[model samples]
Target chain A: MFAGGGKTVFYPKKCPRVRPAPCEFPIIGVPTGEPLCTIPSGYRPNRKCTYMDYAIETNHLSKNYGQVCAVDSVDLHVQPGEIYGFLGLNGAGKTTTIRALLGMIRPSSGSVQVLGQPVGPNGRGPWRRIGHMVESPAAYPELTVLENLEIARRLQGVTDKNATLRVIEQLGIAAYRNRKAGTLSTGNFHRLGLARALLHQPELLILDEPASGLDPAGVVEIRELITRLAREQGLTVFMSSHILTEVDRIATRIGVIHKGRLIEELEADKLIEIRARRLEIKTRDLAAAQCVLSEAGYAVSANEDKLSTGDQRAIDAPEEVATLLVNAGTPPTRLAVEQENLEDYFLRLTGETI
Target chain B: MNTFIASFWAESLKVRRSLITLATAGGFMLLPIVGGLFMIILKDPENAKNLGLISTKAQLVGGVADWPSHFGILKTGMAIAGFILFSIITSWVFGREFADHTVKELLALPTPRTVIVASKFVIIGLWVLLLSILIFAAGLIAGWLVDIPGWSSALLWSSFGSYMLIVGLTYMLMPVAALIASIGRGYLLPLGWTFLAMALAQILGVLGWGEWFPWTVPGLLSELTGPSVEALGIHSYMVVFLTFVVGLSATIIWWRSADQSR
Candidate 1:
C-alpha cells in the first residue's frame, strides 16, 4: 500500500510497496510499505511529457526468446535531429532493440513509441515517416538495383518516380543501378540497402549495422551522408553498430548497451570528458621510472612496457616527469599524453574487446 | 486500395523477374507434353514396342488414344502434377522473401503486411490459373495432333468444366503450402509438406476415404481412383473450402502478428 499526503514516497527501509506512485511512476525494485521521506532519483514525474519531446522513446522495453533474455528494461530517448549511436557487442540485443523499435518484434514487456505513435498490436506505427534497415541489408536478388528501389518506393507510397533514381545517386550506387542486386559486392549491397531506406525521405531513420560491409572510403561516405541528412533536413537517426570509432565521429549522443542493459548513455562531449587520459612514459629502466613516479606521489602502472600515470600534475608538466626521470638515471624513450579512444572506452565499459 | 495496388504491383514485379516463374511454367507444361506422349504410346503399342518406345511386358496406362481418354489423362495429370507445381509456385512466392532476407523490408512499410501477403496470394493464384489454361490448351492441341476420335463441342465443354474444377480444387489446396512456407521460412519444409500430403492422399484414397481428405479430393474428382468410384458429395467441397479459408487466415495472421525477428 503506497499512501502518502498528496506526494507518494518510497521508503528505503521497511516493506516498500512496488506500485505506481501518485506521480504515476512505477516503483521499480523498491520495497513495499512505510512512507519514505524522499523519492528515488530514477523516478520520472514527467515521463509522458518527456516521451512527446523525443522522436523515438522506449520505456522499460524488454524482449525475451523462450529462456534467453534478448533485451532487458531499456528506457531510451532519442531527440529529433540527433544521431544517436547505439553501441553493443554481438548478441548484446542491439538488433533485437532495433527490431522492436521497427515493430518487427513484439517486446515481452514495456512499449515503444516512434514519431509519437505506438508500435504494434498489428505492427501499426507511423512507418510512413520512419525508414529502417534492420540487421543485414536485403533486397530482391533477382531484381536490378533500380528495380529494387522502385519496389521500395512504390511500397513506401512515394509518388515521385524520381525518388528511386535520387536515392540511387545519393547512396553512390548509380553505377550499379542496372545491375542485378545479387551480382553486387558486399559493400554495394549495403549501399543498396541504405538506398532503399533513404528512398522514402523519412523524418526518422533506424538502421542496424549501417556500415557493416563498407570499405573505409564507403564508410566515410555513409557517415557523411547520414550527418548531412541530420544537419540539413533535421532527420533523426538511431543507428546500432559495433564500429565504435565510426559512431564516435558523427554521433551527437552515445548509448552503450552491454548484455541487454544500457550501461552508459552520455553526450559526445561528455564521453570525451569521461574518457581516461593518462601520461604514458616508455623508459629502458621501467622499474626505476615506476619507482620515481610512485615516490613523487603519482599513481603509476605499467602498460605494454610503458610507465603510465593518470596524475593531472604529470600530464600538465611532462617536463617535470622528464626531469625527474633523467635525474633518476632512466631517461624516457617515449613520452606522450594519451586520451582513451572510443574503442578503449567501450572495452573498459563493457569489459569486452572488439 | 492504393496500398493494395502498390503492394500487388511490387509482388508482380518480383514474380516477373524471378527465374522460378519461368521454371514453374516450363515445369507445368510437362504435364500436357507427357500426356501427349502417353497418348502416342497407347495409339500404337505394337509399333511403339517394335521401336523400343514400349517394353515387351509394358502395358499402356491409359486404355485408348481417343479424345475422352486424352482428356482423362490431362485431368489426372492436373490433379497430381498440378498439386506439385502449384505447391512449388506458392512456396516460392511466400518463401523467397525469407530465403532472400527481404521479409524485413516488407514488414515496416506504408503498405501493410496483410496487403503484401494478400498480394502474394493473388499473384500465386493468377500465375497458377494461367498455367492451368495453358495446360488445357496444350492438351487440346495434343489430342488433335494425335488424331484421336471423339472430338465434339459438348464433350469438350463438359471435359473443360471438369478439368477446370480439378484445377480449382488443386489450387485451393495451395494456401497450405504458402502457410507452411511462411512458418517454415524456406522452400524445403513446404515442399516436404507437399510430398507428405501427396503420400497421405494416396494412402487415404486407396482406403476409400478420399472424399474426406482435402488433398485427396482433387485426385478423386479427376477419377484417378476409378470412374466407378462413388462421386464426392458437397461435404468434400466444403472441406476443401474450409482448408482454403484456414490456410489463408493463418498465413495472414502469421504475417500480421508473428515476430519477424529475421
Candidate 2:
C-alpha cells in the first residue's frame, strides 16, 4: 500500500512543543552546510532546511501506523556538543523519534533539521559529519572489529589508520580487534559498534538504545566513555534509552517521550526538582496535616503513613508538614527532605508512577 | 575505492560461516576425483564390455569421464550433480541473512543502498567464477591418468569467456534468492522458492527449449553437451549477459526500495 512514499499524511493542529512565535536569527555565519543557514533568494530548495544553531530541530513531526500514532507531532531541539538523553518507557516512540531524526523513514507531516540542516536537505553533506548506531549494535558480522571501523572511517573521510586504532583501544575493544564482529559477545559487539561510531570523531552522534546487552559494569564503562567524549572531546551525543538510571547518569539535558509525543523537555536538574523533595516529618495529628498544608497553598495528597505536596514552592514540605501536625497537638516522629532525581522526573513526566 | 574493498572483504568473510558454500566447493572437487575412480573401476572389464567401448589403457582411463557417456551415466551425473551443488550454495547467499536476522546490520550502514546491494552481487559473481575454474581444472586432472589427447589448455581458458557469459545469467539466482530473502521471513522460504523456480525451468525445458533457456543455461553450460557444443556461441553469450544484468538490476533495485532497516 505504501508506494512512491506518496500523499503526505496530514496531522491535527495540536503541536504541543511549537513555539508561539517563530524566532528568526540572522543567517550570517561561517557556511558549513547547515540546511537553513542560508537560502538563496528566488530559489526553492528541498523540503528540509538547516537551522542556524540547533544540530537537530523537528517541528510537528509525527508518524502514524494505521490508527496508532507512533510519533505524535513531537518537537525536539538538540544543540551541538551537548549530550541529550531521550528518556522513555517501552512503546514510547524513543526509537521512532531517533529514526525520524536520522531520515531513516519519512515523517507523516512536519520537518526535521538534522546536524543544523533539515533532514533530506540538498547535497546530503551533513550526514558525513554525523555518526549513528541505532536500535541494536549494528555492525557487519563478517568484518573484524577494525575492518568495520575502517569502512566507517574511510566513508567519513578520516585518513589516519592510527586514529581508528586509537578509538578501538579507547572503547576497550583492541583485544578483540581481530575477532569477527559476529563472533564477539554481546557486550563486545556494543563496544565494537561504539568504536565504529567514533571512528571519525563525528560531531553529532545519535545512539538509540546505546547500551543494548551491556552489563552494569559495561554500562559504567560506556557511560564513562560518553562523558569523556561529551566533556573532553566536546562531541554532541543524542541517546535514547529505556533505562532511567542511564539517562539520569549521563544526559546533559533530558527529553522524555511517551506514546510518540514529548511528555516534557527539561534539564535533568529540573526533573530532580519535580521528584526530589523527599519530605520526612515528625507528627501524629494527621487530621490537621491537610488543612495546614492547604493554608500555605500546598496541594497535599495523603495515603496513611505519608503525605506529599506536588510542588516545592507550596511548602518547605518537611518543615510545613511537621509544624502543622505538631501544632495540632501531635509531636512529630522524624523529618527529612531530598530533591527528586531523574527516576522521579521520568515517572512524573510519563505520568506513570512507578 | 577503499570503501568498496572493505565491504568486499567484509562479505567474503561471511562465507566462512556458511557450511553450504564450503560443501559446494568440496563437492565440486570431489566430483572429478570420484569420476577418475569410476573409470578405474570400469577398466576392470566387468562394466567396460557392457558400455561397448574398446579397452586400451589409454582410451579407457581418459579425463575423469575419459570418453562419451554411454547415452546414460557420466554426462547426466556430472551436469545434474554440478548444477545441484551450485544451486545449493547459491541458495544460501542471500537466504541466510533473513534466516539469521543479520540483514538489519547490513542495511543500517551509512553507505548508499545500492552499494549494499552490489556487495552481495560481487560475492555471488566471485563464487560462480571460482567454481567454474575448479570444474574445468578437475576435468584436466582426471584426463591426465588416461592420457587423453586434445586436452587443449587454450580451449579450456577461452571457454571461460563463453562460460562467463552464461555465468552472467547465473548471477540472477542470487538476487532472486535476495528478493525472497527480503519478503520471506527465513532461509527455508527463499531456498524453497529458488529450488521451485529451478524445478519449473526444468519442467519447461522438457517441452523443447530447455537447453538454451536462460534459467537452464547454467546447467547446460556446465555440462558442455552435444547440441549445446554447437549452439553455444558468441551471440549466446551476449543474450545471457543481457538477460542476467536486466534480471539482477531489477531485483537489486526492488531490494533497495524495501524498508529493511530496523
Candidate 3:
C-alpha cells in the first residue's frame, strides 16, 4: 500500500476484496474510475518486488552532533520505481539523512531499513543491492576513469568484466574512459560518480545531488537517463537536491526538508493542486480595484502594481472580476490566475522569502 | 577470500599508480648507499681525508672496516630508518583514503570494511618488506664492491638472521601508525605519532628502560645501543608483538564501527 494525498491506496496484494468493485476506501490522489487493486501492465516483478513495502524506509530517525541536532525525528518511505526527491537548503541535514540510509552514520535514535534489511550497529545492511553517491563524487585521483569504475565493480562483487564499460557507456563517459579521474571536468566527474553507482545495476540508487555540477544540457541528459532507468529497469532513486526545478521536473514524489525536519511529503502531480493559487488584477487604479474587491467580499491586497486575491470567486470567474473592475472605473489591463511553484511553496512552508 | 582478493586488487592498483611507491623505494635505497659511502671512508681514512671525505676530528666512525661493520650499519639503519620509512608507507596507505575522500566509497561496499583494511595492511606490509629486501641486497652489493676483508658465510648468515629480526620488529610497530592514521583521518597525525614515538624511544633508551618499550626494543635488537644479548630479553619481543596486536585490532575495529562522516 502507498500513502498519497492523505489517503492510503492499496496495491493489488493488500486489497481485502477479491473482485474489482468500487474502492470503499477514500481515494485522494488516484484518478476516478481507475482500478484500485490492479497492477500496471508494464509492472514486472524483480528481486526487490518481493519486499513490496519500500525500497527505503525510516521511522523517527534522528542524529545529533553534541548539542546540535543534525537530523531530528525524520521519517522517509521511498517505494520501488519511485524517484524520491529530498529537497532542502544547505545545512538542512539532507546529507545526514542520506548517510543514515547508507549506513555510513549511525542514527542517534530510531531505525532505518533499506531493501528490507535493517541498517547499522556495525554498518551492516543490504548494501549489495544499493548504489549511492554521498555528498560529492570521490575517486582515487591516480586511477583512470575506467580504472576507478573497474575498482568499484570489483569491490561491489560484480563478476561481469564488462560492467565497467557498460556503465561508462550508459553514462556517456566513454570519451573520458582512459582519462585519469583527477583530470576530468566537474560535469564529467559527476558522471563518473553516477557511473560507479550504476555499475552493478543496483536495485536502488541513493544520490546526494545527482544533477549538481552539470551544465543545463548535462543536467537534462542525466535526468533523461535516470528517468529511463527507473521506467525501464524499475530502479528506485532517492536523491537530495536544493535545485527545486530539477526535482520538480523528475521526481515522482517530493520530500521537502527544512532545518533537519521533513516538513512536507507529497506526490509531484498533487503538488500542482495543493499549492496555493491566486488571481492577480493589474489595473490603472490599484487602490480602486482593491476597494471594489474588498467591498464585494473578496479578500484582496495591493501588491506592487496589482491587486491580488485568493478568493475562489475571483479565480473561478476572471471575467466577473474584469467586469467589476471595469464598472468600478479601474478597468483591468491584465488578469490571470497563477499557481505557486515548488520553490515558492517550499519557501512559504519554511517561512522564508526569496 | 574472494572479497579479500578484490579489495587487495583495488588497493594494489592505488599503490601502483601512486608516486609514493617510487618515492619510498628511493628513500629506503639511500640507507645502503650512505652505508657504502661510510665504508669507503672507513677503509682508508688518510686517503679519504686527502679526498676531503671526512674531517680530521671525525676520523673514527666506531667499528673497523669489514663486512660485519657494513652489515651492522645495515641492521641499525633498518631499525632507525625503517621505522620512519615504514611509518610513512603505512600512513600513506591508510591516510590517503580519508585525504582523498574515498573512504566513503569503501565504507558502503559489498567487500566488508575489515577486508579493505586488511588489504591495506597487507599492501603496506608487502611494500615495506620489499624495501627491506632492497636495502639488504644493495648493502650486500655495496659490501662486495667496497671489498671489505671479512667475507665468512657463517657470519653472513648470522648477520642476515639478525637483520631480518630487526626488520620484523620495525615492521611490527607500523600498525600503530596505521591506527593513528585511521583515527585521525589523515597523514599528519600518524606522522606526528611517528616522530613522538622516535623521540620517546631515544629518551627511554638513554634512561636505561629501552628493553621494555616497544618503540625502543627494535633499536636494542639491532644492537645499536649495545650487544642484543645484554640490552634485550624475551620481554622486548613480546612488547613489540603486543603493540602489533593492539594496533591491528584497534585499526580494524575503528574501521568497522566508527562513524565515517567523510
Candidate 4:
C-alpha cells in the first residue's frame, strides 16, 4: 500500500541503502570482530529509502492482560534502515511490545503490520524477511556455529552459501565456527546470535538488549553491529537498550516508554538539538541581571552570581544579557550559553529534574 | 511443504553435526555390551531365582530354544537402549532448538507456528526412526556375536517392529517434553515430569488402576518383549495414537504461544 502525500511505496527495487556515518567517531571504541560502517562514505543524506527508514509500522497496536495494559494504543513508525531505539525501565513493556510485533503474543487491540503485512492476521510468512533476537543470544550451546547457520539459512530459503559466510565474517565470529556454541563466552555467543540473525540477510532485524551484560568490548561489538545493520546492510533495526549512551549513539529515532505508555517520541537529532541549546548564563552580579530580565519579562533565574535561562525565543540574547549586566552593576564577563546534550534533553522531556 | 521441508533439512543437519546424537547412540550400545558381559561372567545358571542371572546366561550363550526363562536379556538390552537413546533423541528434538536459540531464527523464518513446531516433530520423528534402525542394527550385531539359534528371522523382525513402535511412541514425549522445557527454560522440568509420569504409570500398572497411563501405553504398545510376541492390537494402537496426538498438539500450542525467545 502506497502512503499518500510524499509516502513512497517501499520496495527493494525502488530503494537502496543510505549510509548513515562517513567515518567512525572516536567517542566509542568498536570490537575487532567486524567493522560495521555506522556511516558509510558517499551517502546522499537526503535520499528516500524507506527500506532503510521505517521498515516496521504499528498502528494503534495494544495488548491487555486482564487489567495490565502491556502496550497501549501505540502508533510506532520507524524509518527504513534506521536503528530505532526503545527505552523504559523494567516492566515498561518493551519486551511485551516487541513480542506482540513479532507475532509472539496476540494483541488485544488495534493492528500491527511488519514489512507492510499484518503480523497476526497471516502466519509467519512475512517474517521470512525479518530476523529477530528477543532476549538473549538465541543460540544452541550444543550446536557448532556452522550448524546454527545451516538451520537459519534453510528457514530463510537463502540459496547463496557464500553470502551466509559473509554475514558470519561480518559479525566477526568466524573464528568460533567449529567450537560448540555453549563453550563461547556470553559476548561471543551474542556475536553468533548476530550472525544467525544476519545469516538470512533479512530486510528488518529486531534486537532486545543486544548488549546486556557485556564487558566494554562486547558492548562496542554489539553497538557497531547494530549500526552496521542499519547503515551498511540497509536493514531496519528495532532495538531496546537500557544504556541511553548506546541508544543516543545508534538511534536515528527514539521512543521512550514508561509504565506501558509511549510518553515521548521524536527524531534523535531533535533531541540533540534541543539539548544543545539549554544554557546557564552566569554574571558577576546575578541578582541585578535577574531584576533586569524579570522587569523585561525574560526567563531569568537568580541564585548567587548565576542567572540561568535556557530560553531561545528571545529576539536578541547578547543585547539583553549586556543590558541586564550593565543595569545590575555586575559586569557581563561570564555571559555564556552552555550546550546540553541528548541526556539532558531527555531528562527534561520526561520531567526529570537534575 | 516448502517451509516444512526447509525446517526439516535444517533440523536434520543440526542433529547430525552435533556430537550429542552420536555420543548418546554410542553410549546406549556400550551399556548393553559392557553390562551384559559382566552379568554373564557373574551370574549362576544353577540359580533360576535370579532373573538377572538368567537373562545374563541367555545373553552369553546361543541356546534360546532351551532358554531358562519366558524372556531373555534381549528385552533388558533393548529397553535400556530405548530409554537412553530415545530420551537423548527426544531431548534434542525439542530441547536443542531452545537451547541453541535456533527456535528464534526458525520462528522468524516466516513458517506458521504449527509448521515450525511440526517440522521439529517431523525431524524428531525421523530421528527416532533412524535411532530405531540403529537399534536393530545393534541387535542384529548382538545376535550375530552371541548365538540365539532358535531366534528366527520372523522373531527378529517382530521384535524389531515392536521396538520400532516403542521408540516411535517414545518420541511423542519429545514435543511434550520440549514444550515443558521451553516453558520452564530448563532441561530438568520436561525430563523430570516425563520420568515422573513414567514412574507413576509403572505404579499404576502394578496396581492395575485407571486404564493405562499415557507413559506405559507406549512401552506396552511398542516393542518391549522377547523375540516372539503377538501384536498389541487395535486397542493398544488407539491409545498410542492418542498419546502422539496429545503430545504433538501440546507442543504446537505451546510453541505458538510461548515467548519466542524462551
Best by DockQ: 3
Q: Which stretches of candidate 3 lie over 4 Å from their true place?
A: A1-52, B50-61, B225-229
TM-score (chain B) of candidate 2: 0.72
TM-score of 3: 0.91
TM-score of chain B of each: 0.95, 0.72, 0.95, 0.76
Worst ten-residue run, lDDT, model 2 chain B? B66-75
Say which docking band candidate 4 falls in. acceptable
Order the candidate numbers by DockQ, best to worst.
Answer: 3, 1, 4, 2
For residues A1-354, what per-residue lDDT tens digits would candidate 2 score against the true structure?
001122111111111211212322223221222222232444443333322446678999988777988999998987665689998898999887776776656677898977555663111325656777777766666667877677666555566779778998788888988888889998998887788778767768889889878898888988998988877655778999988888888987888888888977877766555665646443465556666766767676676785666456544545555666667666567555646665666676677875
Better of 2 and 4 by TM-score: 4
Q: Candidate 3 — which pairs collide? A: none
What TM-score would every model get versus the actual structure?
0.89, 0.76, 0.91, 0.77
What DockQ results for candidate 1?
Answer: 0.61
User: Candidate 4 at residue B78, lDDT?
Assistant: 44
Candidate 1 clashing pairs? Answer: A15-A32, A15-A33, A16-A31, A16-A32, A16-A33, A17-A32, A17-A33
Per residue, candidate 4 scores C-alpha lDDT tens digits across A1-354 of 122244433444223333222322211111222333233345455344443224677878788888888888888887655679997766778888888788877788887777766776225436767787887776666677877776677667777877667877888888888888778888888888878777767877888888887899988878887786566566778998766778988888889887777888878877665554534666665676677777777787665667667667432366666665676676666666667665665665666666
**Tens digits of per-residue lDDT for model 1 on B1-262?**
3999999999899888989888988988898888787777777877767756343322445767778888888898898899999999999989888998899998888788889989998898899899899999998888888888888999999999999999888888988999999999989999999999999998888887888899999999888863433659999899999999999999999999999887
Give the chain A TM-score for each candidate: 0.82, 0.75, 0.86, 0.76
Candidate with best TM-score: 3
